[model samples]
Target: MSERVILTTSSHLEGYRVTEHIDVVSSECVFGMNILKDMFAGFRDFFGGRNKSSQAALRDARITCLDELRREAEEIGANAVIGIDLDYSEISGGGKSMLFLVATGTAVKVTKV
Candidate 1:
């Protein structure tokens, strides 16, 4: 994997774990994320206060989803994930946020060519 084949795409693959070392591409997508943040802000506003708890929760969820995506790429023998993009939206009746972590890159059994 030359890291040049990396692309941005959402994927949820099973049976994989993200390696400690990963190359995160620049973020260019905000459609899904804007929705989530707006929803969260709305909830907080109506409640007459800030909700750090909610913010933290969403953060964790996003990380988990992204990590899973990375793991999938690794399973395919990708040296690193590039052009990674993430989107997040509200789910669970506006009570919870759904994170969409997408990545595209070349998956190959690297060799000393």
Candidate 2:
């Protein structure tokens, strides 16, 4: 996709009008936490400070999911996505943990107003 797909949390863009409502598009990303990260997170939990590693991982996952969303929109001939939403969750069990991120939006074709 040569042109960048516009993304907005709002249902409408200020300067653009939607010409076509394509479909809902979504992307999911999951990242595993290694033992070292778990250990550091435990230390942070005890010491009461920010967990930089976990923060970075979440940031990376968010970016990846958003990028994938954009790609999906483009693949289906959408020029923009509206009402974008991001969801994050953690899955932990048996001393193993993972971060999950989901990005969703409505793909559409838009024209400048």
Candidate 3:
């Protein structure tokens, strides 16, 4: 199995030197909202409270996006990814609503300093 790729939002990783700049890698994940959950969330919104189900869906989307980003980095022979950026958006105005998450970073070969 491939090792877990190091990921950081910062420009650099402590104790690791970027030796080779591989390429930019990105991954995106989209999750459809459940109608039932939406109804519940709509009720909660009326009450001005947090919606647990929506939060959980957003959490899952982030995790999947990160995993995909790591796989992409590993495919490019990169052991680490730097300058990572994560974005989230909700797509509506259609029959269904969806959550989208995108992760991006620069893949690089790294060595311990």
Best by lDDT: 2
Instruction: Write the residue-wise lDDT of candidate 3 on 14-84 in tens digits.
Output: 99999999999999999999789889989998989899999999899998999999999999899999999
Q: Is candidate 1 or candidate 3 better by TM-score?
A: 3
lDDT of 2 by residue, 15-45 (tens): 9989999999999999999989999999999
lDDT of 1 by residue, 4-77 (tens): 32333423223333443333433222113355576767788898787675566566665665556556666655
What C-alpha lDDT values do all the predictions have?
0.47, 0.96, 0.92
TM-score of each: 0.44, 0.95, 0.94
- TM-score winner: 2
Assess candidate 2 and give its lDDT. 0.96
The positional error of residue 74 in candidate 2, measured at the CA in angstroms, is 0.2
Q: Pick the winner on TM-score between candidates 1 and 2.
A: 2
lDDT of 3: 0.92
Question: Candidates 1 and 2: which is better by lDDT?
Answer: 2
Tell me, what's the RMSD of every candidate?
Answer: 10.8, 0.9, 1.0
Candidate 1 error regions (>4 Å): 1-43, 47-49, 92-113
Q: Which ten residues in a row have the lowest lDDT in candidate 2?
A: 1-10
